[model samples]
Target: MSFSQFGDKFTQHSGISRLMEDMGEGLRTSGTIMLGGGNPAQIPAMNDYFNQLLMQMHQDGQLSEALCNYDGPRGKALLLDALAKMLREELGWPLTAQNIALTNGSQSAFFYLFNLFAGRRADGSKKRVLFPLAPEYLGYADAGLEEDLFVSAKPNIELLPEGQFKYHVDFDHLPLNDDVGLICVSRPTNPTGNVITDDELLQLDALAQQHGVPLLIDNAYGVPFPGIIFSEARPLWNPNTILCMSLSKLGLPGARCGIIVADESTITAIGNMNGIISLAPGSIGPAIANEMIVRGDLLRLSQEVIKPFYQAKVSETIAILRRYLPEDRCLIHKPEGAIFLWLWFRDLPISTETLYQRLKARGVLMVPGHFFFPGLEHEWPHTHQCMRMNYVPDAEKIERAVQILAEELEAAFKN
Candidate 1:
């Protein structure tokens, strides 16, 4: 008649819940501009390629049967093989189908992963997910089955020239305690679009290795696919690392396919979990994406099409923001990759939540900075004065939103 703690926590109204609901609604009031969602940009060329993939499948009469069948929890064998080959040949990672597993999406994969490494351990010891960066991903904040499942290090703010800044891992403050079950991070970070560099990753990997915990790389927006990353950071892989990838950024969010690359033992356990929980990963994404993997079109398209599509937008948005926002009062993080720009409003009169509301009433939507800093019960005041602006919208609309943001933030600062 009541509910378990998991049920209660999952049902609790939170910022992430609001974000998910907004993403699903997929529409704004007729005049309102919504810029909070993380949906991939709709590139016409990529759309054509996707349409072509389905059209060919339909012509070959492969669509109906694929839809009617269960692919098992491990996902399509052919896709796994394609991914395995790509990882081995391109990235030089020693891998095979045995090292790969599939899930509904990166979200479901993390739900499995966080609980897999963390959660209640034997002897009543509670393991935790260690995030070297505090403002990692809001979605992961509530992912673990245990309420106190995460430990995070507050980052050192590295302000750059031209009103830009970055969040560097404060390794000095990173807690490498024995209870840390895993090290997790998202390259091309979701809210801030900060790509954790190779040097930074190596240090974190070394820390994880020393602690005997696996390094979990959430590559939902990183290497070997979609390749939306604009940083010089290389796509990384190692036997001790867990690489989680998704097809969502490849313009196939509806297909709900996520691939996990790890050691065979972990892959086997994940496969079992997938079977018991989901019965099988959806067949649609693997069936279509496998061809792109085999033919090398996915990589080519990402390099030539996808990367530039978002990169241009990032450049455009930076120009717009730099023009409107006061140079000293506003700070924008370098849009290293991903479709969002992170802006910090220094010493504003009101919190970002209140700023979000004001902008919402003015027909603009943005994610407040407060929602991004999870697991850190205490934080710098700057944490509450930032906003993540999804730049995937039209240039005109995004510029409009930026103008509104600058005006509102400037007015707030004066007051």
Candidate 2:
């Protein structure tokens, strides 16, 4: 059994693949406490809205039209127009329908964008994607088709009061050189949930502009839509900036729709790739989202419902960690906006990868931190000392999971 370079590279045991596999396996196994992966919490209000929307769509014939018709490579027209109008009117972004394009999902959008900008080039010189911050999304680790497609700068860890820490982009030492092709960072970042400050974002934007490269923001958990951010963050996009959003966080992961707002040229490029690939992004998510925007319900739901749910979850989860885990030995990343809480065990005897296996044996699941630091060059012990835990599970499950986690940490330190 032989495979091509693409097949071999993708088939390799990758971090994203392992995270997804564990999530699926945990789903199948009973009594599993699922605190791993990036799955959004299923909020009842959101679910009810979706159910009603589906029913209405069915009644209005929108459901059948979306199912049976094939949209252009860019995506369904109504959704694009709705998004463009919403963002333009609300945020005053210089956007039109031409600026937007849809992909099968953000994962595929990233695969297309990363490979488009980074990797081998025409003139024999290769380019790499620069993650100004190291502890980025694990899914991005394998998105590139070529090996060594990324380079990252170590973050400045700010130890805050009350046993919490935050990761700040080390802007002074960020390696934005000629060889770097694109700049990217996730807001309310995936594993850590640290939202880079507005100042930091402006700095990155300035750097990207200076370097003549486009800035790609993975806003899956950021402003105006999912509205998961706990701290202050202004939505930013320009001709040079590519903002990627998703309906997945808005309680439609199965819909498989990803929205990209960029310059017309970039949108066209994405649309061309879409034609070559999935032929067009799925219409279900777009169909639902279009109505949400036009009816002026998206922002209201995000702000009044989804935001508060995650905020309460963060506060409760932090309190549980404080009560169960050793105060002196554990430090949490300041929960900003995302569903995940990052925990760093001080001087643990074993790496988080080993701890993950022990927790799995007890029917608890979490993502080890090492996977998050994809393009980091040096060996940093801090990476292994950390783990990402999601608060999407029920209250009883969360409490039980924390208890088991505390016990395992105590045992590991003793060993």
Candidate 3:
């Protein structure tokens, strides 16, 4: 059997698929230490809140309506209106329901946004999505319908004290050329947890505006809600900025809700896509979140419960890594936010791919770093020696996993 170019491009084995498969196997297989995947930690407090909200919605008959009816492609009007009101009143961003569009998930939203801005153009020209930093989200590597749809620049590696490092946007050599149509980045970036400074973001925004492109900020784990960011970061949006948020990290992945805050034109484009694709975005997440927004519980829980939970987990995981991993050989990216800790095994004898296999054999699972460097045009040895570990697992399990990781690293170094 054969498939079209689109089918072949999407159906081919990819990094995101491997990550999901590993995550699924870890969930189903007993004793598999799940330090892979982007699944947010199951915070009991958040779970309890959701359970209570579910009961309340059920009693009020809101749950049935959400499940049975179809919202417009623009998404639940109430949720959009509430979100717009909150952002306008609280954050002082001029917005309305027209500025917001919801998709089934952030991943789907990215697919639409990427292809919308980039790829084959109407004039037979090709445009690419510019990732200001190289080691971006793995899911983005294959989002484009056209081949070679992304270009990236290497980051300035700032080596911090105590076996830590940070990635800074190399503004000196950013690839903001004519061929680029959109600029995108994930704040509290996945896999690395590196939060680009507010000034850095502003500079990017200015650059994007100058280049006549939209700056897309992936806030799946960022401010206002699901506030998993640990460092100081001011939420930013404007007419030229596209801020994408998700309910997945806020203990609602199954609900598959994604939010895009953009200008009216972009939202209309996304709505049209939604109408053609899924007919409409799913309603359950928006339904629950809308209630939370009205009661002011969404930001409260994110700030009070969600952020603290992940902060503690990150701290504990770092401490465990320090204890188990060889301090002189392993360097961890300074975990500012997000649920992951990026580990760079300095000059390991084997690639992280081999190390991943070795660790998986010992009942540990993690994503190799190579998968994260999409659109990187040059070869950098650092990419092969790194991996991303989800720190949301239990402390004991994480400790055991770190010990196994240390052992594997030691063996690899010796070999």
Worst 10 residues of 3 by lDDT: 320-329
Candidate 1 global TM-score: 0.97
Predicted candidate 3: what Cα RMSD to the true structure? 0.8
lDDT string for model 2 (16-110, tens) is 88888999999999999999978898999999988998899999999999999889999999999989999988899988999999998898999
Candidates in order have lDDT scores of 0.86, 0.91, 0.92
Q: Give the lowest summed-lDDT range of ten residues in model 1.
A: 22-31
Worst 10 residues of 2 by lDDT: 320-329
Q: What is the lDDT of residue 51 in candidate 1?
A: 91
Better of 1 and 2 by lDDT: 2
- Specify the highest-lDDT model's number: 3
Query: What are the RMSDs of all candidates, in order?
Result: 1.3, 0.8, 0.8
